[model samples]
Target chain A: MLPGFPHAEPLAGLAGGILIGLAAAVMLLGSGRIAGVSGIFARATGVASSSMPRLAAWAFVLGLPLGALLVMALNGPLEPRFLSLPWIAVAGLVVGVGTRLGSGCTSGHGVCGVSRLSPRSLVATLTFMATGIATVAAINALT
Target chain B: MRQRLTSEALVALVAGVLFGAGLALGGMTDPARVRGFLDLFGNWDPTLAFVMGGAVLVMAMAWLIQPRMIRPLFTDVFNLPKARDITPRLVIGAGLFGVGWGLAGLCPGPGIAALVIEPLSAAVFVATMLVGMVLVRLFEKDA
Candidate 1:
């Protein structure tokens, strides 16, 4: 295990993942939608419209914080340390545009699409993984 | 008709809650944990991988059940991505997203979820992200 870094929480990870899947499943089976946050955000913000309606999109967006609150209630609040504001802004811009251009993010492509064995999602997932790995490696090396 | 919308909205709210909770519980809401997952060359944490795996496994089952059904429970039709052929937009977009994800260790889901945890920074990232999405929409329209 890596020193200083927390040990991998396989159980919590798996449980949380199952919950994610359940969320996706509930959306798919109940609403016939992909629970992709970027897409949902776009829809919620009136930037884009998908098969789902705007009202429903807003509901989902609002639930995100509520759900996080639930976790905090059970496990306590998390204290996250983010990068500098400028760097974060840059990253956010790229991600927003990229996800739109690409058509999906981790939730849509990585989880929902891949689970369905979608070729496009597969390619997108592979591409992102490769680049994510490379980008992290570069960042680590440069810093 | 109004009742239908309300039900769908409720479903979406519940799904969003689950998705957000899952993200938090799985540690995806933590930027450091996400970055650690991407840090393959260094002290890499495999927690996110398990999270992804568990989510995929369950969602796969959902896909299996989807094909058997004529329509989704709430919607009249299932809205799924139709792109099959790989294209430049997909690859380039995915690449850009990966870079941004690595740079900030944040994505759409976690970014929103983190709003409650780190209000100011997360808000900055989310605001810029919305701007990016709007930029893409405007560009696509002109093109």
Candidate 2:
């Protein structure tokens, strides 16, 4: 277990994973769409568009915060410390562009795409995981 | 057609809600938890591995069921990615996203879900991410 955090919540984490899977299943079965959050956000925000319906994209993006709010009401808010605003802003910028250019992220490539056994998603997941680990190590080492 | 569109939007909203709620319950919305998962060389917390395992297991089953279906329930076509090539864009973009994720401990889904939990920081991240995505779009269009 990592220090400076609460005890590991494996059960909660697994339960949440199942819920996320169910959500992805719903999207795939109901709409034949990948539940890729970055892509959906881009579509909703008009940064990117293809054949996806704009209304559905908007609805999905809007619902993300509502679901989070519901969880907060039930279990109380999550206390996540962040880096300084300037640094976080820069990171966010990179994430936004990177996810767009890469064509997926945790939800899109990691969960949905990997399950489908897409080689592209697999490679992307591996790439991101490696870099994510490296970045964390670098940060811990430096500070 | 209008009725179908409405149902599609509703389904998308429900999917997003479940996805966000899962992210919260699974501790993905917590930067500490996420960072712990990434800190493989440190006092690593392996709970997120279980989370991903559980999600991937369920989604794998979904992929099996997907192929059996004639088409999606709401839409006429299944909008799935067909590209299998691992392009430089995928590797580089995923690497960049990984850096940002490690630095901020948030991805698109969690970043959006944390809007209520850490409104200011999350907003900054999301806003900058959007700008980044838009910049990519502009550059791509020019290219």
Candidate 3:
């Protein structure tokens, strides 16, 4: 679909996204929880509290990387890079703080909440998308 | 209770693994791919939009099923977010998250999923992100 970006895999993206949605659906139906990564991480780390059991939270967190490793073992290695060290650290810190304070991330707000037409999530998604676009624009201009 | 807890945790593991696989397959695990999507003004990659659209479409269906069911399959009650107010804190936090996402092209989910894909980089980001979470708890007693 993207002519400008030849490497842009639309089909893969769509399929993958569907799988993600299914994952969230499973979490909602089976455990009655939003698959908000930040929240799960927080609960596992004891930074947050909820009806979720700690063991469940830990299981989910551990499962994340194991799944990735599974993918690599099957499809070969993936080459994913970071923004060097300094910038990545800064980005990580800001994202962590922002997600906790805002009470959701891409999964919680962008996928689950937005689909349900929640007003707060709608606003949050719009705000983050706009800011994310603007920030990328600014970075491109500066660099 | 122990048996129930085990079931809950196993369900969570399945969801988490599916989520991680989806992220990697959809190309969200790649910072470059995510940045390309964010780089709207530059070589814009529309793959992320397709991913978002597909996920949202599926999630909307899941939401339709949510209200009819009193409780989830394994859990007694649903534990979704309830607050709906559009607050300054939410906007600010989301905006900051956008900045971080644009800068590193790594949000909470992708950041964690990339642990096995890009070990060193993902670890740094996750560690700093954890510290950021801790800082929030330390500074904001209300949080």
Candidate 4:
């Protein structure tokens, strides 16, 4: 694991943010589609179709793992904190609902929406972020 | 459809950087933190919500400004998805996402974002997520 920071490293976070912005911009500019993860995932699964969009979507999705592999190869090894299978399955279900409800996942609204400056995206993004925040708060309160 | 390769590459690079930075700063790069937030009915970490809120604030500003400034970047016009009241699809998708997130503590963007810091689990989460996406597509096609 990377060295843990005391409060959250602004530099590290900034770097991460830059990467997301760059990725979204590139996907749009090059492929002419928003780098929305749900859409990408849907297309990859064949639930949705758009030849060029699908290719780019696949590339983006595949690149994610490839990038992780590169990091793992270099970093030695990393282990995720384990959670029960049922819990993981449930979490997946919630996120799926949220994505559909919000009309886009974080990648689409949070990244692409902000970049393109869409009002509807703004509201949806706000709702998403808010809901996420509330969920965390409630989770924390109960736990 | 064709543009200068260099410019396209630059866009991709920038988007990636921004995306990565956001994940890192939001504390989303850490599954432990995500778990903490989801452990709400249990441990109750509430920080993720705040981070999401901050992101929404930035997005809100962008939404207000985008249409006024840029008519359209690549497409003839920016296409907005139809605004539909929350439906069963929304509920189902969000619920699935939450369950996965609570268990795995990683959403697609943040999960992929974690690659910069952690690799193994991130890889697993991303792979499974893709599988889920593909499954959705296959089922949809059959329907």
Using DockQ as the measure, which candidate wins?
Answer: 3
DockQ of every predicted complex: 0.83, 0.78, 0.83, 0.24
- What pairs collide in candidate 3? none
Best by lDDT: 1
Looking at candidate 2, what is the lDDT of residue B43?
A: 65
Positional deviation of residue B116's Cα in model 4 after best superposition, in angstroms: 5.1
True contacts kept of each: 0.82, 0.78, 0.81, 0.24
Query: Tens digit of lDDT per residue, candidate 4, span B18-135?
Result: 5545555545666777666555445555555555545545444445554464443533334444554555555445444554555556787766656555555555555566556655
lDDT of 1 by residue, B52-109 (tens): 9999999999999998989988778788777798999999999999989989999999
The ten-residue window of minimal lDDT in model 2 chain B covers B43-52
TM-score computed on alpha carbons, candidate 4: 0.64
Residue-level lDDT for B34 in candidate 1 = 87
- Model 3 chain A: weakest 10-residue lDDT segment is A1-10
Per-residue alpha-carbon lDDT of model 2 for A70-110, expressed as tens digits?
88899876777777898889889999989998998999999
Please, what are the lDDT tens digits per residue for candidate 1 over residues A8-62? 8888899999999999999999988899989999999999977678899999998
DockQ of 3: 0.83
TM-score of 2: 0.96
